[model samples]
Target: MGKKINKSSQNGYHHNNHFSNPRSKTKSTIVGGKYIYHGEVTVEELAGALNISSADILKYLLLNKGFYNINSTLDDEIIGEICLNYGFDFEKEDIVEADDFEHYKIEDKAEDLIERAPVVTIMGHVDHGKTTLIDTIRNSNIAAKEAGAITQEIGAYQKTINGKKITFIDTPGHEAFSAMRQRGAQVTDIVVLVVAADDGIMPQTVEAINHAKAANVPIIVAINKIDKPGANIDKVMSSLSKYDLLPEEWGGDTIVKPISAKQNIGVDELLENVLLVAEMRELKANPKRPASGTVIEASLDKKVGSKATLLIQNGTLHVGDYLVIGTCYCKVRRMTNEFNKPVNAATPSTPVSVTGIDGIPQAGDQFYCFHSEKEARAIALKRAQKLVNKQAKNEGVSILNLHDKLESGEITILNLIVKADTNGSLEAACSQLKKLQVDTVQLKIIHSAIGDVNEGDVILASASQAIIVAFNVHENSLALAKAKELNVEIRNYDIIYNMTEEITEAMKGHLKPTFIDVTYGHAEVLQLFKASKVGIICGSRVTDGTIKRTSKVKVYRKNNVIFEGNLASLKRGKDDVMSVKEGFECGIVIDGFNHDGDIEIGDIIESWGQEVEKK
Candidate 1:
């Protein structure tokens, strides 16, 4: 047997090697805030050249520009940003030709790289039970726990199937799946398209297929709701054939599994098929090198500050190692697996949530390790300077120019401004709208807030050239006139799904869907309170069905709906209530109705919302 080296001894060997072989020094100029750089510099090289810490360069990117850490290929835009942020006037670097980047390329050694688990993404239309299926496989209640019973965020989870590991990325919708692709991260190895047996192919189902096809990934159809009374497997298969996903039974290569997420049927067979596809791909990576991977999701935690969920595609990530992610740098102080269990290191295809980062890195940002904290900080500082310069030059990039860019095919970005009546509505609307992005075409939300359409919103939309979308909110006369004068497009919706369909249509440059409102409840106004933050509080008794505080409401004056908004606050006396059953008295506040004379007692209030009948 060969002699084994202790962990400390191995680390010492690497440390000695790093100090002995010095990188070639290149002369550069820093003239009046302008820095000169050579072709295709990695984060480490850039940090070394600037005599700054790589972590500093990354911090600059995240705090100032909202960019990822340093595992970056410095582009012209980024180069400009770095120069500005570092207090440099400009960067005088030779334009890097494709072939000139040879020195930066990593030669793949077949022997060193070993096979890794395949990353699969499940996608489908709203209410198709994508999360329900995941819940069934994991034996967890994820779908039931999410707000609105809809998976609104992207999460990565791992499972063991017949002793083989598989990584699954649960994306919100087709838009989020395509958004990752648009960022140039082809992370998914396979796409599992879940379709309801009864509902067959819906608008989002088609969009999911298009996104999967665009990525050139294999798709497995999961016909869910098989146990439902209206389920028809043959009908689902027929609808799928038109999209080129021919069922295996029909002499095609596509694998179709009929499953009831609620019943947990045929899930074992689905796992076997996934493993089969994964084996064919021969997915592999090098785990001995410095860790490098993409950000799956990121958010700020009240306790931990900024936290990010990272999918390590290659190499082993260890605690205390300084990492550069999309322009921000952090030392890995803590790392946890999907189950929140502490782990010292992570290997290829592993999903880990790590803290100790300076700021929240954007999703899809690539991360890599650095040898020293000094190098990381320098690079981060230089990048921060670049961002400062870029910001000063452009002021703020608006989405309003998106239409012209799309028409010219110069850039495939859909910039939007979203307005809603409540914070929850705003969050849900943005979450669903992001799923429409595919290929080069991406959806970028310029601004999202809770309120009625105002002149400020119009101005921002005009500057950004973004389409204004209103959900459970209305454009006032001033905002409407301003929008007209600026030739800004304003779209309105009372239902969340309808707005999603409209945005998808706009992205595809197709016809918009027509919607019809259906009232579910009504109440009679008994009294009004003038002194309240919720505009005017209308004390009323539920006259029909039940009135929910979160439901959309419309004021009816003599059989015609006059004012429409949200039931901002609902209360039975001083105690807040979610709903009031028929014959129960409750006080209600309209979100946008602040005028004293706008609402009066004895007016009938109807709670209503819209739904899409069909495309």
Candidate 2:
């Protein structure tokens, strides 16, 4: 009996030892910004290297530092501070510049992180129930609570499908979604396309596919609105064929799931398909290291009292650990699940809300832990210090980009996302923007879509701070309210060429005034040609505003404006006049206005001169 008890004690000691020496692998740079390394370098020597006292170094080995009379578990802030004082930069990429950087504080190198959740973005044409489908799914599967825009911003929530986690980034703007997909964040795993069965594939649908293809991500088609009376899965599948997304039944790689999100039908099947793709992709995450990923979403936790709900991606975390989140540091006192249950630990692919910190951090904030609380504080101070220095550096570095004739100290080039009605109309609208440009500020076109704007596009535009243009498509009502709240501009246009030409002019900062010389001219009708279907040719005089063959004009009669378009093929009898003087008479034929207007010899025509606004 004495021998058996002794043997059991020995076995228990060995079991504890296994956990004590889990692995002598390289210490990872985790939260709190201290790049931890696996080496037995003496603390006094490290303190000298880190430019700190031995006591400060000693504090790095305590669990709660001097606060809780606890043994040997060190503070993360102390470790963070040591890294910071040693000239380590945690905010930037991990590079130990011996000459440039004296100390090395490293955050978890995201490159070393394993892929866990496959990022899935939902996209499709206007009113194709893209948002509706997303909302319905969020409501039903996620428990129909306040699911207002589950993807409120680029940062959104995550869902599990058969244990495979998938994060849904609410890239609010369609065009912006396209932009992000284009930037090629190697993190994307799959794109779930939502196409209304009744509406079939539209322009944005194809663009989304193209953008996904641009990013080289696989796609899963969700045939939404199957509950509708006219829901045509066959038509949706056939239309997708135009973009090469043939259904599985049709021998294509794209998996098409006909779902009625409104009716909660096929939701399970969708979840199953998502998991199937994840498994096929062989997605896995290392649950041994501290969590690290791009800040998908974060906000101050007012209601929760304290501690941020960090979505762990790489490591297991426990209560009472210190976290270095963004530039802030806080010791975790307790971890709570989504249901507010106190949990001792959270592993990779888990998002456990925690408390013990003084305040909540912002969403999308990167979080990590340190060896001790002391390290966490030190890291936070250093992060703040580095930020100040960076601000100073940018101010010095950016002044070089300016040139003479620039009015402002810094050139604020406004980028835009222009959405319009149809292909032909878009062509004409974009061709004539020769009026608005300037040298100090240039207009940049980031992206454009052809439908009502969405939240995904809005978020991207917000991130880049770009304005939006909606030619015929209006803003989504919900999106409009959000836009108004956010003060995002949504410019609408009905005329195709006018919208295009104006944006072209806008890009050049030419709106202040035309730098080139130009004049306006008017003309009156004398006789008509092709007086019926094709249009009418008016023999008229340029009365006011100097007119040229390619000048822009607006046709009007009886005080009602007929058309605001460019002068198409103006001629003086059989000769094409390059410039029609104020009094010169010319023969002009209007395109598409076949009906006879009241343009008699006494009638008038108005023209506006244009000059290129160089931005």
Candidate 3:
């Protein structure tokens, strides 16, 4: 009889001899006193080498860090994390040839002529009728009797117009777009750009167009608000032409439809145009093959528990399936719709919510189907190996320091995420960064998002290996902690040139020189002019740097750097002045302090302030 292979049996190997495999034993150097599988090795192979449960190895990322079921494409973000946490590095393998991307393909076996519905995603400026357009279509398609016709959606809804079915993904206008974009699943069949005919193209409209173009998806122009008296479709079309999106009537390939979602006109024409594009592109799917796709969106829902909504472009998704998303894998214990309703299976081109998986997956994560849980585990192991090698190459980042690298053409460029509170601030900061220069290095604005440095921007910066610079924009307080943990450097600057100049200097390996100014002066509590728990009023003279009121101060009694604190209060004879210049006599007070014997009329005092002048 064959040996009964069980997880327990594979995990009880010799611990010291765990990494005996040639692939993973490249070097003896250890990160946390444990050997990482520096090269490709099977999970089973690793489990035995490490003398730990296969499940345990998968749990923490590797060798008992404790992570599990990371095979499900249900999320890729989690998988990358799991891989990294366990000494696996996916970034190392990011440069694989385009050919390798389709390496592990699974043929769809489903006979279902997956007439992939034309997925028309409406994107535009804020307050544009994106939601209204989708809603009107959904309501129009319903049999007027489906009384409770989709008052709310699970992110998307399907509607049939002119007997052609289309699915519209209601992508958020902000914050969420990047997550959705990152999934690499943005195969927009047709992008219905909602340009307010009167308001014309806005900044975000241009961004949306670029995102769609980057995805290489077709676009369909929807001139919204044609019903309004102020609406000027001609002006909007002229502006769109600047972005190369000429209307069909103007001899461009792009289709244009003017409709008022409020009045619900020209909706049918939009559907027909989308289907026409789909047919031209020959969008087809085999539902029979193993399911694979990118995650639409995922959230750690309190009730659903790691809820993920996936838009399957091809193949069949069934409950009880195991899958790999990026580096993480998961078991599909439950399949559902965005509504949280249980379903037997979801097929190609269908959007469904799923429950399962060990953690929340990254939105837009590419998912792939595997032969089984075992195969998924094996593949994940291989992927993890490739990542480890990649990281080893990048380990130079810490050793060389970002500054040194930038100084040398060896690291000629640095990327930054530019953010600010308003459009003007954002533009000014971006202009400043663009001008920062060195011999060979240049400051590049890879991602410039206007608004506070929110969590979405934080995640993107982390993924892109970019730094965040906030100009007049306050980061969400909560992100500060996570940013620190990720070692993500976030710099805050109120002055535009100061921010850019520092970044430039740092990149050039000549960061602004740090200088300290010392002050020589003293203040004695004079008759307790005023006393409080904060400090006691007194008189003093001749503090260096004119004794800047806001300058940091050290209240030293015996001159041992005592009372390391700020000079909370300063006064010049009740005039609230900053400096008692050199020999000029002035009355001053210390906040949150009182003197009894620390000083008499001549108790010596000294102060200093740091000035970080740009190089």
Candidate 4:
């Protein structure tokens, strides 16, 4: 809405009389020409007012050189154009609130602050003993209790060493580490990079190093899995040296601890090193001031309604404190420590689960405690309204513009909406996507769910300037159309590995074609027959060009790539042939591409080869 108007009297309405009979003159006058918009309206609302289907409005907007969704706010210029096209006049109506909300800012006095514990984040490659190291130090088996036997979510814990408190933030993987950092939550004071002594370094390990270096935090290397028969501490150290993390024993400043997490070997030394790093940094915070912290994790509970794990970075959090996190606030009903032990209060750098939030705040959201409940609620509601307005003002961004935005040398944030076939698949997808971040462009998942892509997903992607990633999920016709109309990128994949690889490549700006595809021939899979020798064989006919034995092939079903590989064997009338010409019958067996039940009748197969060159 625009600024408020001060007119006291209502404007007079006028109606035109064109070919009206004498009886029509006595009827009530119709205000046909003009309309006023209080705020931005959607296509569905406009269609309802005009007594038309939403689809009709969509087509109208498309024909009028506009791209929008049913839920997208119509700009003033577009609204005016629509009115003129529909033979009507329009004006904007502005209303002002009697009480404009002011932002709440808290100032802390020097006397109220004190030294606090350092918050540490454990990061490295998956299955590199990160969780194992944490469990060994805390004397808890959390890794075995997680879904898929892997930590797919962030967890914060606290442990006391030599009468001093130390907080540890363990993320699912490096992807989640960058995800939180992109959201502006820099809660980690130190990073402990765990490298497997046997496995050496991995892709995710390199990614973790890059992220921690970008955060500019001191890194402590924990070379784990030393109990394994093939463990080589020297090899692991050599690999880490490439990342500029030479061990302290090698005359470098970085601290490296060798430990076996499963056997709890050298676990105490690791904690000692962590404390030493904290001491060097001189981490301190005022505990007597109002509490301020960052959320480590948030989820909806059937019994508790909404709950969040808050890591108090500063001040003191009491049981009855009223806290505001993002656009939500609540009076703290209770607080529990990492072990779920009830606690009356939490000081700086301690992880506590709070049970009185009205709704689930997002992970990485900054929270602050107010003096009173009324002020917390007022500020939270005002923030919620501001968020809604800001989303409306952010127009959709296309993938084409993404490169340009990154090149501008500013912080480029990529928002993603992920949809998957199952809960496990969704979790895996999110975990993998979080590890993809370049220095210039950071990837953040705005929303994730377990379902097929739908219109609601499209609307959210359009509003948030996010790309939609669907894993083993297909979209309906409406959603596809909306995505294309809004120029939103929708990437679909049946294989999880492929999805991860493609996204990682995209983040590195390597999405430009690395291999140029050269089509050799096309064929149609007429029938599928079982075989013991080659798994499954497809009866086919050469439709165009020539099918060569050395050429690679790809199966396309409904214009989607199903399988791609090299041709294993080629046959013409039961005779092994080097090539098959057009209009000839043939049978083909692809190498390492077992169709199983994916290849169906009427599916098209294209034989091609790729030419790769360094860019």
TM-score of candidate 3 relative to the true fold:
0.53
Local error of candidate 3 at 496, Å?
Answer: 5.4
lDDT of each candidate versus the true structure: 0.74, 0.57, 0.60, 0.73
Per model, state how many residue pairs clash: 54, 73, 36, 4
TM-score-best of 2 and 4: 4
Best by TM-score: 1
1-615 per-residue lDDT for model 3 (tens digits):
001122232223221121111122231123443444322344444445445565664545534432223121112444345455555444322222211233343333345455777777778887677777776877643222233332222266667667766777877653355445543445457778888877888867876775566456788889988988899988998898877888878998778889887788887787788888888987787665556676776778787678677778766777767676655666787887645588877777788877775566776677755546665555555555554444423322221156755544445557677788888888888877787666666556656767777665665554445678888877787667656544456788998767866676676566535565655444433344545543555566564435555455556554554454445556676565545566666655543345665434544345556543322
Q: Write the per-residue lDDT of candidate 2 for residues 339-368, one digit (tens) a residue.
A: 568888776556676666644555545666
RMSD of each: 18.9, 26.0, 17.1, 20.1
Look at candidate 1 and tell me the lDDT of residue 433: 86
Model 4 misplacement above 4 A? 1-111, 395-615
TM-scores of all candidate predictions against the true structure: 0.53, 0.47, 0.53, 0.52
What does candidate 1 score on TM? 0.53
Candidate 3 CA-lDDT value: 0.60
lDDT of 4 by residue, 266-352 (tens): 988899988888888888776665567888899988888799999888767888888888778888998999888999989889899
